[model samples]
Target: MLRYPAVEISKGPRTVPWGTPEVTLDVSDVESCTTTFWVRSAKKQFIHRLKRREREESEDSNEDDYVPYIPIKQRKKLKVRQAEKRLGRIGLLKEQEAGSTSEGTSEGGNEGEEDEGVNLGPKSKFSLLDQHSDLKRKAEARKETAREKILKEEEKILESVAEKKALMAVSELAKGIEYTDPIKTGWRAPGYILKKSEHEHEKVRKKYHILVEGEDKPAPLTAFREMKFPKPILHGLKKKGIQHPTPIQIQGIPAVLSGRDMIGIAFTGSGKTLVFTLPIIMFCLEQEKRLPFINNEGPYGLIICPSRELAKQTNEIIAEFCGYLEKDGFPPLRSALCIGGLPLNPQLEIIKRGVHIIVATPGRLMLMLEKKMFVLDICRYLVLDEADRMIDMGFEEDVRTIFSYFKGQRQTLLFSATMPKKIQNFARSALVKPVTVNVGRAGAASLDVIQEVEYVKQEAKIVYILECLQKTAPPVLVFAEKKQDVDAIHEYLLLKGVEAVAIHGGKDQEERTQSIDQFRKGDKDVLVATDVASKGLDFPDIKHVINYDMPEDIENYVHRIGRTGRCGKTGTATTFVNNGNDETVLLDLKHLLIEAKQKVPPFLAAKELENEKYLNIGGEAGCSYCGGLGHRIAECPKLEALQSKQVAGIGRRDYLANSSADY
Candidate 1:
């Protein structure tokens, strides 16, 4: 601190006196100096002053015009305001220009002035407010015109719809009138007989709950003898221990014998087969006795069954009666079984040898007819046994085709356990002045059969079936919904050391025939089958029917249980149900049980409260469409399914045709 000067420090660049030379210092001199801090501060000040001078000089040389800083947001707002003001000025100018042009055109009434206005310079390309207003008005006018046109089209469509509805109503009324015309037609019993028994007929019908519908319906018979069967036929009936005519036979026989087309609906195992069979034989016998049939000359009666088994059974019955006729010194009435899975040569030979009656299934009969194997020219009696089943199996088209082959007016008899409204409608179209014989409600379970419904899980169904079998003795019928299920049940029963035989559509014809024959002869204890056996196949001694799984359709369920409780014999039917079953079918089953006065399970009874609306819909008059107790004709699933199938088939055919044309 010998002779050091005080250092002056500032926040900005250090100032030096003007015209003063820059000072330079050596590192060695500074290090030797005792007051090194003063020396370093002086040196930093001199270097800082030189740097500041250089920066000023560079900025002076590179500097551009000065602009005041403004925030981006404020700049943007200012620009938007300026643009709005410019648009306002432009709009004002356009309006003023339009007004001036209009004034000029109005003030100058000369044609030259108007021509000049129309021929304006190309510079006047801008649109005026008046022009814009004119465009908007024209657009609105177009929209209004379009709306009026659309409304008119809608009115036309509505009028067409009304006209179609009127036509439909007129057609329905005409159909009603035609069906109800009371003029008696077709073959009928003698006036004296019908008149004498009219009062007794009413009493008999009332006593048996027989519902007869038609114009001049024939009187129902109270005894088999009233039919006046041949002595041989009477003996055959007595041998079979048939004491009196069943309810179906009481009305059905009389109607058919009177030569009237008939729709006979009765409970299963109620002697429906006999109802048609006896009438067909009587017709055939009368034809033979009148004029004997020569080679390929006659098939006076034709019985069309849905299943081969049913056809075979019918053929056997006819043969048995024919044998009786032959033994009674009448000409032998030969009947041919024209079903599939048999020797065609034999059937053809029988046809060539002149047969009086023919029992066949739809498929084989259609084939025979298509091949010109036999003619139906002389076939006057047509019987459709299990008519509902035939329609359900897709034989409707075949039946219609067969109808085309008829050369004369045939007495068509349609017999079934259940008659749905759809079938009734079909009958109206197929038969003329047909008499309807109905015993009990259509699709109702037999009062003689005890129905048992149990909740069994899928895993426990097989085990539960064994327990179900134990409830009844041998010669039981176990019906399942699927062929695989039939096989499974058959396998399970055999493994459990039970004697069972199975038959399904998947089996060979020979195997199925053998199984049925064995079961019929009591060689097998249990018969596991699908719906193939549910139709009009009669097993006289079947004491129990076990439904391994309920059918989807309530009508099928009725038929399945009908296998038992036939011919006035009491039987038991046990159905296994679980949560997996369809609620609709379960509801139908519940209502059927309630109607039959059978005990319902807790789960089923619980659903009754929730479906109260459906419960009373078909109270006394069950579903007229499908005869289901849980639904009305409008909600019939079977009818809907058939309709949908037909529609889909039509659509498919149309699509295929279009595709072919495109190719």
Candidate 2:
């Protein structure tokens, strides 16, 4: 597309050579030869016009262009015209003599144009067809009307029957639902409550003994019927087979319903799920009243958990309750579960279709946020279930970063079994004047869990589990520390002729979900797993919890054993604490056992006494001489010189005193 510049060469007047004069040039002829001068931009258009003209000429060169296609009906009409003309000469036909009414004409477009045998004498084709065709059409119309009427009546009868059945079911459910509203209650009003606030709080306190032990604990809501929850929520509770509210649910539901941030400190499986879920459903239904029903393109509520299993469990609970919502006048609730080891495209599609609630693990949710898959500005309810575990898993920063995405005033609820210093900081910064509900002792195991530890060697742990399995019933949960151990345990169980499945982080989401399903349905009587399945997974009817490999952290131990002994079901938790296998966590393990009111086995007490006598290197990092952290006593130059001086003056006795100052 290179273009050259136009060259205008000016030359002095000079006569051409001898042959130049022979060329004859007429100015008029030169001017007439030029048709039109096209601009640079219009040159292509000019050429196209020429091509179009040639194309038109080629198309018009057909020989049959003048002969129009006369249909068969028209051919018959022409013959009729000729006959009519002949007949008119004899005066048999009058008006049609001119052949004005030809085929395909306004005058000829009628049922009569359709040929019926022949037109004899002066009669047209319709004279034969009219009597039969009209009769057929009227009869068919009558039959169609009758069929439509019958179908409408049948549909009405079926619909009426279905309506009656639904009504009967609702009436039956209503009969069992318990509801009471003795007095008007308020968010700030405690004295006017139906039950004595302090007495009920103390009862919930003595039972759950929740965290934030020293701080204020919200008034506990004990009964489902007395709280007078919305009728729909009550039905949902009944559907879940929950007749009464847990201590956490008691304080939590009312606070959340009154529109305030709350941090519920209760153990796992204490029905903390319903506390947040009921409010979220109520909020969505309320929003539906004010806003037009639409695919909730963005979430109105968000629930974040530490692990994939917990997030999935919360998602199921949310979906279950949402299913119980009224079908009329509002959009159906939609929720999406996003976690690691799953397809991203499908999750994005769920968000695209719209979601009213999103239950997701921190890592997966953050990944989606990074990809801008969905907007979080619309989420008004933020629930951080198992907040302590989330921080332990290193999701603290991700949690804070996610909180930044909320553009509106959000209601943040942080539910944790124990609130540590880090969790306290997180709640302080994220929550808005939050009401704290402490059900049980902070950093303590549930009272319902019957805990016992074995002094079995590491290699004999599986043997101990086998014996326990033979004694215990089906539907037992066995926890191992690592994935390979979980797999080995599961394989061993299978080889031993026991039905079992293993779930861990190494397995994909589908495998994990399938394994969980098998265990849930009792298809697999035994479920071997790692800590991945420990938090927030509700497996009711879990008869026994066996720690084949004791958890390294005491918090995990609480969560692991919390699986069983849930919902007032007495269950046993047998932990295998080998003398040498788990020495590092022995001290914390003992303290946890003592605080939980479980008998610290003789071996555990011996370990503590032995640790007191022996050189403990894994003790809290601090100054060796002063027991302060951040520096070593041997590395201290002042202490080094002092020790050298003391060695000369006070001998080795002073050295022991210097090192054992805190001891």
lDDT for 145 in candidate 2 is: 78
lDDT of 1 at 241: 81
Per-residue CA lDDT of candidate 1, range 44-104, in tens? 6656766788898888887785444545764664455456556665455435545563433
Could you give me the TM-score of model 1 versus the true structure?
0.69
Among all candidates shown, the one with the greatest TM-score: 1
Local distance difference test, per candidate?
Answer: 0.74, 0.64
Q: 190 in model 2: Cα distance from truth in Å?
A: 11
* Candidate 2 lDDT by residue in tens digits, 322-354: 766654323577789887777777777777777
- Superposed by TM-score, candidate 1 places the C-alpha of residue 203 at a distance from the truth, in angstroms, of 1.1
Top of the candidates by lDDT: 1
Least well predicted 10-residue stretch by lDDT in candidate 2: 654-663
Task: Provide C-alpha RMSD values for all models, in order.
Answer: 19.6, 34.4
